[model samples]
Each structure stands twice: as C-alpha cells, then as structure tokens.
Target: MTPSTWSPAQPPAWFEQARHLAAVRRYQLAEELTRRELAQNPRSPLAFVVLSMLLWQQARYDEAEAAARDALAVQPTYDEAFYFLALSCASQGRSAEARAAIHTAIELDPASAKYYALRSRFELEWHYAAQSRATAEEGLRVEPTNLECLHRRLLALRQLSETSLAEETARNMLALDPECAPAHLALGELLLSQADYVTAEAYFRAALRQQPGLAAARQGLSESWKQRYWLSRRLARLDAWVARAGQWLTARGLGGHLVLLLGFVLVVPVVCLPLCLAYGWSYLRWRLAPAILLVRGRPLGQPCWQCWYRLICPAWRWPWGCWRPTASGARYGASRRPNQSAIT
Candidate 1:
C-alpha cells in the first residue's frame, strides 16, 4: 500500500479501555483487552504498544520486543513505542541498543524526568554503578522530589560503597516517605556496616514494622544481633586466653610467654576473631535462621532448595520422586510402583 493509502485504523473503545487499564497498572486485564482489540485491528500501533507494555509488565521480554517493533514499524517516531522497545531490549540483555533507544527518548523529551529515570535504570541493569548514580543525580537535580530518581541514586551509592552519600540519600528518601521499606533497609545496612548496632536495629525494626515481609530488613536485624554477640564473645575469649598465658609465664619463667600472650590477645583477635565469628555466625544462621519464604504468615512447607535444583536440572519424575504438589485439587500422589510416576 502507498504511504498516502496507509490510513491509520480507528481503534475500538475496547482498545482505549485497554490503554487506560495499562496506564492504571491493571496489566492482566489490559493484556486481555489488548488481545481482543488486536483481533479486530491487528496492525494498529496503539494496539501493539498496549500489548507490548502488558508483555513487558509480565516480563515476557522477547514477546514485548516483537510487539514494540510492530508498533514502531507502524508509527516510527511514537514515544511510547520507543520507550517499550528500550524496556524490552534492556530486559533481554541488549544494553547497547537499549541505551541508544533511551537516549533517543530523552532527546525526544529533554524535560522528562521519566526518561532520565529510565536511563538510570538501564545503567543499573548494566551494572554501571557510577554512571547510574550520575544519571539519577541529574534527574533529581531537575525534579527534586522525584521518588524514582532518589531511589536510584540511593541504590547506586550503596552499590558503589559511598556510605555517607548513600546514608544521606536514604535518610532524605525516608523523610519524604517514612513508609519506604527499601530506604529504611538501606539505612539499616549502612549503620550495620559502620558497627552502629543500636541505630541499625532501630531502622531495621522500623522497616519491619512498615513491611513485615521485608526480608532484607529482617536479615539486617539478624546480622546486627549476631555482630554484637560475636564481638562480646571474642572479647571474653581473648581475656581468658590472656589469663591462661600469664599463668604459663609464671610457671615456666619464660618472658616469651608474655609476648605470646600479648600477640594472641591483640593480633589473634584482630585476625582470627573475625573468621571464628563468621563461622559461628554462619552456624547460627543455619541452625536458627527463619525460612527464606512464608505463605500466609506460615513457613513454606515445601523444600525450596530441592525444588529450585529440580527446576534448573529437569529429570524424569519416573526415575526420581520429585513431583511438586499443586494448590489445586489435583493430588500429586507419591509413586509407589516402579515406573508409575509421570515425567513433569
């Protein structure tokens, strides 16, 4: 068809509804509505962009990329098309293309903090911590109250080990949003690293109070307690070792024992104490650590490690009893007889 003959088809009301739904973050319903609309007008760029966003939200990156390409082919300069194209490319490890597309988006809308935020996100995805921090900082300079910009800056600072800056940014974020769980968790981790156990515990507790399922905050709290416990134990052990060495020096009449005692009390605790404490900490973690996940506030009954391993390396269920249970009424009964279990 000639370019003049390429009349853009009018999208149905359902297509508009789907766009609204996607805008409001109701992705599943948007996907269904977009599918229905696409059935009627398959070549509509609007339809394709909506479908692309839905697939992107669901993390179907390859499908999202194809849909974005379809939209871009119909309307090459469409901003939303380019935006979703960048997202799909980023999701699938096409960082160079994603970066170029994001740059184009920013060029198209230089004043948009959302575009800068996307740039920061792509930098983070590529593990360019310093570049991500700069991008986020620039975005925040333009839009001072932008939550995404502040969050990105905080995360990048944390990753780069810029402790003071990260803590400051996290505190600012918390001041803006007291219920921000990640900010609280980040501040807690920073304090924990600095050996500020009491303050770290308070931050972690606050995070848990806001979001009980925040595993990072819970982990920070656990680590803070372990640190204090280990420090106390190490000091006690060093004192005992020193007392024993002093008695040895008195009995053997050797001045070397005093030196040895000093070395053991000072150097050994400096070096060996951390290692010993780490081992004990890990032992306690293995023994008393809570389950990594919970369902309805109860510990997950299924063995996640075994399930994850099975998922990674699939094997015939008939050869091994590795069938998983379903929440539905389908009972996955154990295979009693030989070759009775169906392969998953």
Candidate 2:
C-alpha cells in the first residue's frame, strides 16, 4: 500500500515482524526490520517509538533518546515514546530529565502499573526511598500482586531501614513464589544484619538451591561460613595476614629465607631430637670400642661421655644454628661485597 493509504488498521507486515522479534529478544533482526519499516514510512510515530525501544535495549542511550524525540515530534501524545525517552535519559544519568519524562508518561497513562513500577525503580536508583515507596504503593494499589511493585516496595523498605516491614514484604513474596531467589536473599540479608549467621546461612543456601548462579546468595553463603564459627573467623584473619606478610617478604626477597627459618625452628625440634639420640648412641658404641681397647684391651658396651656430648651438642646446635642469622648474614655479606670491591 502507498504511504498515504497506510493506517494503524492496516499496519505493515515488517512492523509486526519487528515487534515480534523484539518481544523474543532477537534485537538485531528486530532492529533491521524496524529500520526497514521506518524507511518506508518515515511519518509513522509508532515505528519511531519501536526503533527508540530497540536502541534503548541495546544500551545506545543517546541515540535512543534522539529516536524517542523524533517519535514525540511525529506524535506528541505517545506515552510509550516518553517512557522510552525516560529510560534512555536514566541510562545516561540524566536523573532530572528522566523524572520529568516519566512523569509526562504517567500523566498520559495514569493506569499503567508498569510505568509506576519503572518510576518507583528510578526513585530507588536515585536514592529517594520515600518517593520510591510511595510510587510502589500506588502501583500495588492498582495491581495488588504486581511482582515489580512488590520487589520495589521490599527494596524501598530495606533502604529506609524498616526491617520488620521489609521482612514481612519478603515473606509475602516468598508466599507468592516460594522459589524466588531475591526473596530468599532478602531474608538472608536481614538475618545476617542481625548476626544470626546460622539462620541467615540457611536462607542464603535456599536462595542458591533455588538459583545457583545468584551472586548475592553466593557471597552471603561465604560470609555466613566465615562468621559462623569463632575459629573460622580467626583462621580467616590469620590467613589474610599471612598472605599479606608473604607478599611483603617476597617483595624484599626474604620469603624463601623466612620459610626455611620457620621449618628449621618448628620442625627440627620435633624431628631432630630422636634422630640425634639414635646417631649419638651408634657413634659412641663404635668410638668407645677403639677407646676401651686402647685403654685396657677390653670390649666397651657404650661410652656415656661420647653419647652425652654428641646428643647435647647437636641439640644445642640445632636451636643456636636456627637462631643465628645465617640467611640474613649471607644476604648482607653479598650486598656489601660489591661496595667493598669498589672501595678497594
């Protein structure tokens, strides 16, 4: 049909296809189709609105806002076009412009629960908890069971520190959808803030069981385990300290020396004492044989003096050797050798 003959009653096939593709999230194909439709009917305001929405979904905010303005130029009363412009403006951090645009959209279509929900979310993003709560309540008044409004209300209450009310809202959401990950996570966070790690962990685990890839639930679960036991918390801190200390030592080339020192100090005491005693007794038996024969031409059972000296000396040396700064002294000596050579 000719452009002049076209009307909403006989919408183009391409426009229908574009809308369908957009609904199915096939944005690229839908965008191509919408542009083709717009090329044939430049004056079609709905086509411009659809193109704006397509651009908005693609995160081309400036282009989407321009396209939305074009839609408004063609049909000044298009509420959906204003809504798209608001969303585009919001994406670009134009909060005042977004609020004005969304207000215009709501004035054009006051009964739209989705618009109310969107406005409520915008308020929440802008940190206007009171306004967000009011907007969400307005939406709920219109549609009592709207999930978007319900979630927004829950978030606004939490932001306002209305803990009991937020918990009630969360429970209501769970009552509506038992497998809702956000509801479970909300309850978990509430409990966690109260230091009820055991109960919080259960809710966080439930959220994960419902939705395994939920990052908030995963983080909450990890935190729950860390704070669940005193020992775990202390160990976690110690591990963090050790990691930082290792990094600090490695930067100064002392990491390897520190490891060796710790092994010698802690491990040698436990292991070397037994091995040293065994070696001392064997060596004394062999050494005393020659000494006894030389002294009286008799076979010696054992030499107590040699045994005591060998055992005591090695044990003494083990700790004294560890205490001595052999590694540090070598590092110091090597560092000074170059300077000493230069001076000589």
Instruction: Name the candidate that leads on lDDT.
Output: 2
By summed lDDT, the worst window of 10 consecutive residues in model 2 runs over: 329-338
User: Which clashing pairs does model 2 show?
Assistant: none
Question: lDDT of each prediction vs. the true structure?
Answer: 0.76, 0.80
In model 1, what lDDT does residue 60 have?
91
lDDT of 2 at 85: 88
lDDT of 1 by residue, 1-344 (tens): 10011112575677667656766678888788778888888888878877887898788999999999998898888776787789889888888899888898777767666667788978887799999999998888788887778888988988898889898999898888998888888889999889899999999999999989989988889888877887865886798998987788787776766776788789977998899999999986553322221211232354555445544442444242333345763323332343436653
Error of 1 at 19 (Å): 7.7
Residue 251 accuracy (lDDT) in model 1: 79
Clashes of each: 0, 0
Off by over 4 Å in 2: 1-25, 196-199, 202-213, 233-344
TM-score of 2: 0.60
For candidate 2, give the lDDT. 0.80
Q: What is the per-residue lDDT of model 2 for residues 1-344, given as tens digits with 9 covering 90 to 100?
A: 11111134566777677767776778899888888888888998888887888888788889999999999999999888888889899999999999999899999989877778889999999899999999999988988777778899999999999999999999988888898888999999999989899999999999999989999999999998889889988998899999987886787687677876888899988899899999999987754543333334211443555434433444345433212234435311122123566678
